[model samples]
Target: MIISQQLDTKTDHQVQAIPLDSIAQAQGTNIPFEVCVDHANFVRPNPQKHVNRLRSDNHYQGLSSQEILNLPPWKDDFFYFSYYAGLNGTGFMGFEAGLWSLSNSQSKSHDKCVDKFIENHRQDQRNPMTQLWIFNHKLKQIQWKNNKYIFILEYRGKGFQVINYRKTAWDLAQDQTVWFEFVDTKGNRLGGCTEGWTCPIRKK
Candidate 1:
């Protein structure tokens, strides 16, 4: 049997509360539960929770040493919702630019995007790219913007980076589906193939 939960949004804006047991019995015990909020205003209710405090102060609060590969698609994707302040730490390296690439779990391959980037860069000064991704703490989505880096080897191979001011710090969160690419010296992101949040949808 399919159980439908209806929420009333008239005047008061009320949610229908039902027993979790009833819903679990209707679906199977082995299957995961899906909570669907039918229509969202897309309005953020709390502002304080979205702040990334680590960058605000010189001190840091370390992120849990999460195994990036272990999480489910949706949960893994939610890493975009977090702030990787550690990228600006003492052990941090310099920047790299990259073309947007898809995760292994995604239908497309990162190599395809990499190849396209290589092809595009062959004629221009920007060849041989690096990939980067970050968790957006506010939006709760993985953002590819400002995270990718493209490097030209012959230009200036070795150099040091100083964090004079973090312009990209404490920005809004981004969704993973969108594509972006750019190269910068100080803030260009690093790393390839990051884990994001798990999918909330149920398998039919």
Candidate 2:
């Protein structure tokens, strides 16, 4: 969905804050693990378009191997997750990552089906690279405000990271949020993009 159209036109300082429960209720459901998998599996974009977009985007272009390795998990790890999750008819990309993190860190049950799925696709045409980060931290919280799903993640030493996923008023496609951010507990920005590719950290 187009985040710009979904947001209130008020200045950043004047934006209203709504509770997470209210936002989830209005949106119908929290971002379920199943939904993330389904979208990754069933929805297919043109391979050429995908490759070209990756090549053309300034945000992704001109990066060294070390730079790519050190990039944020969302950018580096999520790319492979999206690729592998979409490989088979089952979409388990985001769910697998979440489960992997939970299983390793919190002793949660790791779904065997997810592991087998990844193994089966290991040599597939779209060979997604293995994720460097296990994303051991679970989502600290998820809130909805101004037509966005605000995902809060906690890292051991990183304080807090906030991701805002927005939706449009009339769009039917259940797509991922194009704009997101990583912020700290005090509302200080760590990293993220604003509506028009503006600096969310600076804007905050």
lDDT of 2 by residue, 1-204 (tens): 000012221221211123212113354344322111111112112334333333453654685544433333322221212223342312223322222122121111123334533563565323222211213122444444445434444433211111222233322244444344544455554554432211223211
For residue 155, give model 1's deviation from the true position in Å. 43
Give the Cα lDDT of each candidate.
Answer: 0.21, 0.30
Runs of candidate 1 exceeding 4 Å displacement: 1-14, 23-39, 43-54, 57-204
User: Considering every candidate listed, which one attains the maximal TM-score?
Assistant: 2
Candidate 2 has an lDDT of 0.30
Top model number, lDDT: 2
Give lDDT: candidate 2, residue 139. Answer: 40
- Native-to-model Cα distance after best TM-score fit, residue 14 in candidate 2, in Å: 40
Worst window of 10 by summed lDDT in candidate 2: 1-10
In Å, residue 110's CA in model 1 sits off its true spot by: 36
